[model samples]
Target: MDKIGFIGLGIMGRPMAKNLIKAGYAVVVCDVNQQAVEELRACGAESAATPAETAEKAGTFIVTMLPNSPQVREVTAGENGLLKGIRAGQIVVDMSSISPIASRELDALLREKGAEMLDAPVSGGQEKAEQGTLAIMVGGSAAAFEKARPILEKMGATVTLVGESGAGQITKLVNQMIVGINISAVAEGMAFAKKAGVEPRRVFEAIRKGLAGSQCLEDKAPRMFEGRYDPGFRINLHIKDLWNVLETSRAVSCSVPLSGQVIEMMIALANEGHETKDHGSLGLYYEKLNNVALKEIQK
Candidate 1:
């Protein structure tokens, strides 16, 4: 197995990197969070002090799972960045949810150094990340995709090369757009049902197998009913993705009214300090609107 350099060991990144180690790859990791790095180090992975050192030590593949475009850019191009030490023929797989435009610009930078970059973002949140069942979407050259496929497969159940440079990030934005909208719809509908004197759990059990079913509904509705708002995916992060959606839509002269509305709901939740809560707490938004709450009803 090739030596892998992993960066940004956060909620998603930490588990994904650990899966690579479990797959028998020699992994070197870097993160500002020393505890996370130490945790992976204790799991038989090596640790690096900086991205540049990580790049120099890794054999071919370097993966980054970060927050947004700014963080990704800083790690890849800032002083003491991976670009400082990345060599010819190296492949950088960025799994961060960022701007497609930024992905393209970074790809251009990597290409100029005789290296390749793949904009590979993922879905399925923290749960699937820990289970190594994320759905990864890649955008880059076919050759790079093939080279990275084995590494990706170890961490994702579904790894797809969607299109050329920046395409994966665009696809991620689409995912976020639909996810925000679906979460809002689920919250609104469930809250309405509860307010109308229907058992929210029964409503979920009834419609979950019907045409209204979705991954979002199945995952989030239960969280809503249980009143558990832990961060499978945080409201603030979804808000960030939604802002990217609206910005990209504007760039392409497209309109996304539903996304616009959902973003407002996210902003409202964030304003109320629910930003760190799971996006399933979108139910709280509707609950407040209707003056009703979603609590665990006996199944």
Candidate 2:
């Protein structure tokens, strides 16, 4: 087992890195957050002062769980970046959900330096990251996928190589689109039920077993009912993902009408300064629209 260099130890990254450490891999970590790096270090992982340092000291694999396209681009290309210290044949697994176009650009940059890249964006949120049961969508060559699958399996429950180069990010954008749409639908339904003087949680239980049922309803409905809007996956991040979704849609001349509508609603929530809350907080937007507040139903 080669030593893995891990960067960007935020909510998702920290747990994934910890899982790697627990799985008996020698993991080296780097992040802007010193406490995050130190936390991993306490778990038997080595800490690097920078991405370049991690790449230099760690083995053939580097995993980055960054926030967005620009950050990913910067961390791999900046002065003390991954490319500065990478050797030929080393691989980069970017688990961030970002722009597919940007993923392709990063792939080209890595290939130019005689390295391989996999855009392996993950879903299933921070809790999944902690439990090592994330759903990882990978896009890269078959060889690279095979080489990376074992390491990926350690962090994800469902790992699949979907296509080449940018497919993983494209997949992630699709995931975000569905997520945004689903959350919005749940928000709308719960708000409507509350406005109609029906218990939204009871409505959730009734419809949850029918054709209207879905994981979104199951996972997010209670949160909306309880008015808990803490950031598991921040609404702002979903907004960013939708931005990528729309940008990529325009590039390919695809019409994402529902996605566009959801983005508009998300932007409304963000502009109102609710972007830092969990995406399930979308119900608030509907609550405002309906002029009704949803009360938590008795379990």
lDDT, residue 79, candidate 1 = 93
lDDT of each: 0.93, 0.91
Per-residue alpha-carbon lDDT of candidate 1 for residues 116-193, written as tens digits (9 for 90 to 100): 899999988888999999999999999999999999999999999999999999999988888888998899899889
Question: Residue by residue across 1-299, what tens digits does model 2's lDDT show?
Answer: 79999999998999999999999999999999999988998999988888889889888899999999999998898889898998899999999989999999888988988997899999888889999999999999999999999999999999989999999999989889988899999999888888788888788878899998888888889888888889878889999999999889999999999999998998999999998999988888998988888746456
Q: How many clashes in candidate 2?
A: 0
TM-score of 1: 0.93
